[model samples]
Target: MLGFLTARQAGLDDPLRLRRAESTRRVLSLTLNPDRDVDRVHGNGVNAIDIDAVEGRYMLSGGADGVIVIYDLENFSGKPQYTCKAVCTVGRSSRHVHKFSVETVQWYPYDTGMFVSSSFDKTMKVWDTETLKPAEVFEFEDNVYSHHLSPIARKHSLIAVGTKNPKIQLCDLKSGSRIHVLQGHRAEVLAVRWSPRYEHILATASADSKVKVWDVRRASGSVLTLDQHNGDKSKASSEAVNTAHNGRVNGLCFTGDGLHLLTTGTDDRMRLWNSATGENTLVNYGKVCNESRKRLQFTVSRGCSPEFVFVPCGSSVAVYALHTGELVTMLRGHYNNVDCCEFHTDYQELYSGGKDCNILAWVPILRTADVEEESNSAPTRAVGQASVNPAFQDAWSSDED
Candidate 1:
């Protein structure tokens, strides 16, 4: 009877149980907006890119064929159909050939002089802009899917890496040795992210269909395991287990404040979970198909009325209202399936990459007069900010609309 029940329950994912999660995310109807305000610039399908924090004048991208590109995103010319020229690339013949498709590239967060890239070849390298040479290289046992450096980690100089192996590795930037490993994931870990609020806190997603939050300082065990059901015995364990995802949990990200975690699964679902507890928030993003074996990079608008989540769905990039789970807008331009995306807070701008080998920029709809308005509309309370846990308040008042 136990075996019969297990087999029957394994085939189901209870929608009612999922709906009973502490919070139900809303889904917004997306009104396709033209990506006019920001420029659509890359010539090839872009693999990755990063925005400049200080100047806000330049952007950088890495391509599928191993081309690292830099673009000046400012409106240099008076015309609207502006072209973004290749500033420089590490170019061909460089040993940094990123043996397989370049998986992820990111800016150093604080400065423009350096950036980082991870590859299927099982390595992550820090690159110096001036020489385009690897400043630091860390090699791993299996393919590296994704890696992230904290945006504001001041004390611990560590980079979190997710590889084909089930373990999460922490490599020290200040030292050359691998500091520690966070284990428990039984399948290849796909994404690794650090909490903005807690310096030592890290989160990981895996092929095992579990999302685990860890404390890098502890060797004990995971702090939380994201379960689909709220540990309700009335539901079958299979139904409880399948709650998180039916496929690989490929992408994981925390909101700015570290209260909520966003996950994109190969099962065509995007879920919001409370960071403090592993409770699935049940904000239903209908079908977010993430086929990539690596992390599906998504971004949160730094300052907005209601925060937004930018996820790369199948062939296009889908923007969803963070907590409500509504699809706000789709930024279409890349002829191929979009892969990764990043957001800039100060200007409320977005950039995305796809298999079509191009990177597109998206921004709010602005007229000439609206563009000329010299008003700093930055959100006052970081409301609607894509924070990780349950703490960030919705800064934007829906009453205004």
Candidate 2:
């Protein structure tokens, strides 16, 4: 660490190298935050969670009880020990509540005025954030498994939806109706995601053990189909030329930059792929226990040099190196199977929910000296003491009293 800092000071290393080092150190020190907790309001397990891109101050969660909640994550109390309280909730008594389990919930990318939720009741509802009333409802013939609105799309307001049926549905928020269907999978479509880099690109995973990437503007079939065998017919058996996993592919997420994609399946394996060429990176993220029959919501770190992937594995959330596929750590708190997790880039914090009916917050661990000094008036480092590691000294501010 000192060598990197010395090189940085001497103008020999890239400035990004220093930032990546700091980000890596912070990520490696993550621990469950005992002080911060999202208030519990769901009667059943939480299935989906999302933090909007605009502010990252508010969070949304949907649960099996057919309830949706919005939480104010900011600590306005001006103290270290402050709870993130629920701002508002759409409870079961509400006339607009879903009849069955809410499978997914996401905020509108551009604003907080509207959000979307899909449920097993075969309906996806768009709600006015202020009134908590359904502004638009799109009904499906089968149970809706997952839906995602492109976060970076400027030309389209399309929401890619997957259902119990093999066909993937694309609904346009502007038209308030189902615009088209992309068909290729032979079984239920369990997961769907839009490319953060390209507005026209979409990805879908299915029970048929296949993952396909499509271009919405093309009249032809998918642009690329991910093949675990990489088109090596000799090594491939009687199976199709393209198969992302050997079992049901239930989870899909793109990296922070949308350069690569990460997928998890019921096969107890997670694979990373090159989003452009559809080649499996073949980074072996060993047995990531996934048994969910529905869409599994996972997330990746943003604004970090070497990012990490957070996936729900059994009763714990497994954190792995995004590029190397190394299992960094396992967050074990939920008594039941964890279903979903969302990463907050602003503070390098993590929020997760599961069958335990609880949402747990994970924050980067602060040094003991700093924490102790903040708790009470204690002797910290002297004003003019030379530090053993110059990196800490360079990063630490000198304005403290």
Candidate 3:
């Protein structure tokens, strides 16, 4: 660590290298934090969570009980132990609250004054943050499963929405109306995501076992329907042609660069794909244990070397190395099945929500002086002792000892 700092100070090494190394180290050291907690505001499972891109200080969460909360993530008390308090909430009492499960929530990409949420109530509401009222509402005939606003969009103000309907709906924020529909999937569209790199590129996953990439500017059909077999005619059966998974693909996430895409399915599998070519990278993330019939929200790390992917696998959140598909660790905390998770890129922290009605924070343990000294003396021994934190140790009776 000191070597990198010395080189950085001497202007000999690229600053991004040091940043990546530290970020990677921080991610590897993450564990369920004992001191930090999110105020339990949900009576039902938390369905989605997102941190604001502008400040990264506030977090938005949607719950099964039709509640939406904004948490103040900035710890102004200058203490290690702090509970993230809900700054405001759209409770059941609110007239603007969803009538059913709030499936997805997201802060406006450029500002905190506006946000959006979708629900099984068959409506997507564009909200005014200060007034806690719906600025605009887009109603649909089917239950909304997922929705996404383009984070990099400058030319358009479109929000891509997935629903029980097979067609993907694109709502124009400027006109306050459903402007376009992209049709291809034969079943419910389970998930939709806009590319972080290109404003017009979008990806959708469906219960029909297909994942399709679209260029919204074109009036034609999908640009490419991802093929798990890489278009090998002999390998693909007739029924499996151009299918991304064998079952419902409920999750879709793009890597930071938007060059790669990750999809999770009910087939108990997660596949990585090349977004541009619609070719499966075939990175085998062995059985992910997905059982969710609705949209499953997962996230990928940003600003870290060898970025990691975080997915809810049963009752725990599983961390995997992006390219290698190696399981790095399982973050256990929730007592019930985890439904969603989000990475706080600025702080190198993670927040996950689950059926347990809890949102757990996973924080990185800072390197202590004693551990640093030990590592300098005997690196292997220090590495072995890393997990020996007293907080995680179990107590045993004298008889057992």
lDDT of 1 by residue, 86-177 (tens): 67676566777576656777788788898888887788888888888898899988988888888778888889998999988898888967
Q: Who wins the lDDT comparison? A: 3
- lDDT, residue 279, candidate 2: 94
For candidate 2, the 10 contiguous residues with the lowest summed lDDT are 379-388
Residue-by-residue lDDT tens digits, candidate 3, 230-315: 99979988999999999999999999999999999999999999999988898988989999999999999988867899999999
For model 1, how big is the CA root-mean-square deviation? 12.9
Clash pairs detected, candidate 2: none
Off by over 4 Å in 2: 1-13, 372-401
* Residue 111 C-alpha lDDT in model 2: 97
Clashing pairs counted in every model: 30, 0, 0
lDDT of each: 0.70, 0.87, 0.90
Give TM-scores for every candidate, taking all chains together and pairing residue i with residue i: 0.79, 0.91, 0.92
Cα RMSD of all models vs. native, in order, equals: 12.9, 5.6, 6.7
